[model samples]
Target: MAQFLNKLIPTALAIGTGISLIDSSIYNVDGGQRAVIFDRIAGVKEKVVGEGTHFIIPWLQKPFIFDVRSTPKNIKSETGSKDLQTVNISLRVLFKPEIDKLPWIYSKLGMDYDERVLPSVGNEVLKSVVAQYDAGELITQREAVSREIREALTKRSKEFNLLLDDVSITHLSFSQDFTTAIESKQVAQQEAERSKYIVLKNEQEKKAAIIRAEGESEAAKLIIQAMASGPGFIELRRIEASKEIAETLAKSGKVTYMPNTGNVLMNMNASGK
Candidate 1:
């Protein structure tokens, strides 16, 4: 019975040791790369699980994990315009280390890349570009500002082995007095334009009235000249006018008086005889 118990104890001990080895031999994935570090044992690459795990190393190389995801850096600065007015600008930058150049990034800029590089580049780009524009231009040309900033940052980031995804202007602030003055000037200019239109419209109406008057005067002169042309023409026109009057009276079922010039002529002839 003692011999049997001793064999069972050894078997149990061996099983427990195997279980411990299995637990500690997991693989660790770093920086989204398949590159992994082993914990204590070697040749454990086959045991790697999805994306991340603990692994056994031969105690020679140490592992450092870097985040492979896109990171954001927010920066703010005060820049002077060409007009020498200080404007407060805030920007948010999205960037990440170039995967292919990660080794150079790690070597040159180190882990505090965001802290050291982002602010300096953002400020330099913003201030340099803004200094070329006046306060009014800066307010009106937001897209230009964004483009210049993006280009400047992209160029600067290349040296640091960074990939610039986007640079966004989050906020801009100018003096209240400057804003009010600009608005007031715009309003005055609009009012002047409206007044000029009104004056032009009035002039057009005056010219149209004068043309109508001139047309009416010319028509009256033509009618007077036609009437004075001859008595026969006048009598013919009177007869036509009388016929039109008779037609109108007939439609209304009314009688109109007609002068008898033939009777008057007969009486005059009998008197002469």
Candidate 2:
């Protein structure tokens, strides 16, 4: 019985060891995940392991899993514009490792490949693209600038076995001096416009005054000529003035009497007077 027990113990121990080795060797590349094998003697393998259960030899080979999912990263940089103005820029990049290049990425950058490469390359692309545009252009042509950055960053990331799903500029700001200068410029423009308007208004007023004076002078000349011809015009003007005054008094709800004796008198006893 002791002999049988000793043999059974060794067999069970061997079986347990094998099970443990199998468990360690088997790895699952879950959804949105990929794996690369690293060999103890041969280094990283070139073949990428797809999703599902994959096996690797126990200590001789190890699996590195990577999430092949789009990730968002933010990068901020302070750079100079083409006009030599200082600008602060923020960038957002969505990126993932190329599935086919997983082996290379694992070999070179490990699991944190985006961390190792994105910020440096993102800042590089942002600085380069932003430096080509003036501060004002960055504001006016924001979409174009973002497109350029996306193109440049996409090109740059390819060299590191990365795929850029999207790239965009999230925020931008200039130095306080630049901001103040812009405000001052806008104020100056507005003041200039107001000055133009005022000048035009003054010119129009001057023209109106000249026209009024000319009209009055012409009327006086005609009146003098009429008076030289006869006193008829003066008589007619006095009658018109008297008629106008009578009409005005009538509209005022007052009673007045005009006499041919060259005098006027009001009715002292009127209703509502």
Expressed as tens digits, the lDDT of each residue in 1-273 for candidate 1 is 999999999999999988776665544775455332323344222222235665553244334445667778888999889998878999988888776555455456766777888899889888998899898788799999888888998899877877888888899887778778878999999999999999999999999999999999998898788788867767887999988966676555233333675322123334556
User: How far out, in Å, is residue 24 in model 2?
Assistant: 1.1
Best by lDDT: 2
Candidate 1 lDDT for residue 12? 94
Local distance difference test, per candidate?
0.74, 0.90
Candidate 2 displacement at residue 206 in angstroms = 6.4
Give me the displacement of residue 186 in model 1, in angstroms: 0.7
Look at candidate 2 and tell me the lDDT of residue 87. 91
